[model samples]
Target: MEGDFIKINEWLKPLSWLYGCIIGFRNFLFDVGVLKSRAFDIPVISVGNITVGGTGKTPHVEYLIRLLKDRFNVAVLSRGYKRRTKGYIVADANTIMTDIGDEPFQMKQKFPKVTVAVDAKRVHGIETLMDSDKKIDVILLDDAFQHRYVKPGINILLVDYHRLIIYDKLLPAGRLREPLSGKNRADIVIITKCPDALRPMEFRVVTKAMDLFPYQDLFFTKLAYDDLKHLYNGSTRELNSIGSDEHVLLLTGIASPRQLREDLKPYVKNLTPLRFPDHHEFNDDDVQLINETFANMPSPKIVITTEKDAVRINDTKGLSKEIKDNIYSLPVKIKFLLEQEEVFNEKIISYVRKNSRNSILAKTKDDDKSKDSHNSGNGSRTISF
Candidate 1:
């Protein structure tokens, strides 16, 4: 559950074959159409991973939103993982995490211009989007590679640079939800969270092990942080800018906090890490602990959490108000390697545009052909495309 043990489990080695068999059968069924994947009339691109968690899919989804927002009418559809609501719930300014799920809420907060909706049944969610306000030209499906019920136009699969699928076994033993063979479904494969000091040999080894499709595009990206900011009031402050006189408390609820801790090591004057599970919903009790900890930590203490954690903690009320007031969140964005940002950006944009345009043309041509057939049969009038 921690450290190198995360890499492999001795007891799970035997179960790998069984996991592989189940996954293989599932893929085969889908491939043969014995299991149907429903493709919508609208453009849907899925951003997901083969491995279970912590590949930085959230940032990738955000990257897509930023890349496509200007040119297209975009919307996000997710399962709303731990949400309380059932059926379809679209995230507006009024939508709460309890109602629409935390990730969608976070998406709503970050990209208010775009629509965010969630349904355990993705087809229903897509239907809601199709029937809602705002002209949604495209839909981005978050964490949806496994959700084959509603197929996407483009599948962008992410694999962590350090945790290649080839080196990993299936679940129970390893992190993969499916086998490395499942890479066949991805149109774009990204190796995320790469070190800044990547060399040619390392890149070569990764790319080789990736064993991608002939047409699949591969890219590398890393998590780069911005200045940490206050959680409650949204005031900006640099990580290293923390004065030597300032004592700080770090709070995080994510799959990985080691990276975050290391990032603030040089900058923060004094540090205290309050770790929680990934996507942890902080209650009053947790906030109380933070409050007490900060109160006892001398006079000038600053409380900090990651951006995702900040969003969750922001809603906590009661005695946590003063503690929350001092709570600041550090923001980080995905920075791609190879200076190919524009190239990758254009590739995705161009694909969506090209396919969407093609679909429109095809539909128009079909409509015209149908009209012509009707006219010819009735001996009435002509129709043209």
Candidate 2:
């Protein structure tokens, strides 16, 4: 994980060193089964980041769901970050963001047919999902890279191009939740939030910079901003529909809104950002501020927020009809760069299809014949962290 990484928070180096030591020791416990990591017979795919903040995990998980939902009964398990209720709870029609995390709620709202459940204990969550009436062929673990309790069949690690883990330090200093060495756990690595017009040479430089193990397939993805949908009614509005003369009040309560702001810059030149901490629960004061800030804007102005933030805002009552009318959720999805979608999809599909309990090969195939250190495919290699 060596590169020309920009170092920040140099003053907190001592604390970060201590945090890294603790995290490394904890990981060691799971590494040797002292903590007892559980592996499911059903193909489990984990979409997570080494950093504490968002690395586009939600969009990528949704991508996998879209890819495999038709071919397999897909289930999503999340820790339900900041959820009021605890212990495994299955998402139903009545499920809200409070029941599941906003990210999971977004997924459930986007793909209602797919089963969604949340529990801090991922092992318990997967077991419950398996025993439920739903015939789950595969399970996707959302934000579980540090969650060693549930071993996934395919572990995908996402890195933000804007804030590469290589450029980051341990928590309380930088965004990384674990040591950079933790990257070795990844079976697939994705550098996300790439420029839409990234050159081939840039890709080569990044791929070489990553210097990933041969067993781990590398992919690049950029956020494909879609049409803005109304917060309440789900009415679609094209991003281009917002005229150049129009003002946009960007309300975001995500881990990193920098990239989102950058993306919106070309289309909406005049954007006022009302930022909030990640997973910030909305209150009446926040709502009032949003209304006031947005109302204070000139004519031909609108309020736009992320889909995750929109879910929370939708649940927050007392929004004036004016704010409701103008507030829209900008939906974003990951589009693999360099046309690597086919390769990535084939890898994901093949792993699940071969490892699925219902598959005859799953019963007959020898575990020793499986490929890679992950045993997810035809080739296996080991790399020192």
Candidate 3:
């Protein structure tokens, strides 16, 4: 089956090549300044992936939020993929999952005080966010790796450890949205979902294989799944509460759940996965199927899902009372491996501090807000606020 899958994708290599050429040309236009890329006065840090599907982008974004929210006025801007409405909209008390997309809404719910907004045009999003009276110290561009209209101060790229870009092919033939060369644009490259027990020799081997530029910094992180929380009531309980004889129905909508599945296995007697597509919306059929699946399981069975999926499920109507009472969300976060979290955090904080409108750089300049240096010919500018 694996060989057959490979053969099928190999046959589609021609299409991938055509797609790559178009993407490469677009990138070239941006590089040459024919297509304008704007820079904001305040610090803008983008976190994204060149590959399609889940590389744990949300967890990593949350990690940065946790690191910076205490010291800075942080805001998040996302494109709100597959949202119901159009144009830029800031998440507020009345915002639903469909209004700002699942990930942004999830963040807003998790961090009530943080600002979260969605706009297809990231440049407009950043500008509007800047115009706000609350004074955003920094903005995080979620999943904006491909949206080059705004040149972020720090470009953080995430790669799935299980699906290394070195071994993968371009889109249609593989998961990559662009050529492996696209990895060069990343200021910081992180390998997500890494094994906790990875050896030093294995680490050295991967570092060599990546062949990153001298200026690029590399880091590794693994998913750290937290204790179970009630899907409706927002109450917490330990995973160890599930007895050894109890069953767990691991339901997922994200692209990759292998690591989560593995980590959950030892906690329960039998682990049964009811998988769905990435960001899948639950309908009547799905609801029925889930109820049926859980019914067939033995007694003392409960359902578990990732926090991302839990938000979508939270608003879904017509769920059975029993199912609602039993389902729980497993929160996950990223932790830097090899004791390098402090190093990564310092780099981020340093960049934000240096470029903030209220930073020492701005205070020393003695300007009203910023001293942006605009390039005359290209229409692009570097902001040293």
TM-score-superior candidate, 1 or 3: 3
Clashing residue pairs in all predictions, respectively, total 1, 2, 0
lDDT of prediction 2: 0.87
Report the lDDT tens digits of candidate 1 across residue range 63-154.
99999899888889988877887888877777777887767888888999998888888888888888774367789999998887878888
Better of 2 and 3 by lDDT: 3
Q: Name the regions of candidate 1 deviating beyond 4 angstroms.
A: 1-8, 244-246, 296-300, 318-322, 357-385
TM match of model 3 to true structure: 0.93
What TM-score would each prediction reach against the true structure?
Answer: 0.86, 0.90, 0.93
Best by TM-score: 3
lDDT of 3 at 93: 94
Query: In model 3, what lDDT does residue 19 have?
Result: 93
What is the C-alpha local distance difference test score of each model?
0.81, 0.87, 0.89
Superposition error at 27 for model 3 (Å): 1.1
How high is the lDDT of residue 66 in model 1? 90
Candidates in descending TM-score order: 3, 2, 1
Candidate 3 deviates by what RMSD? 5.9
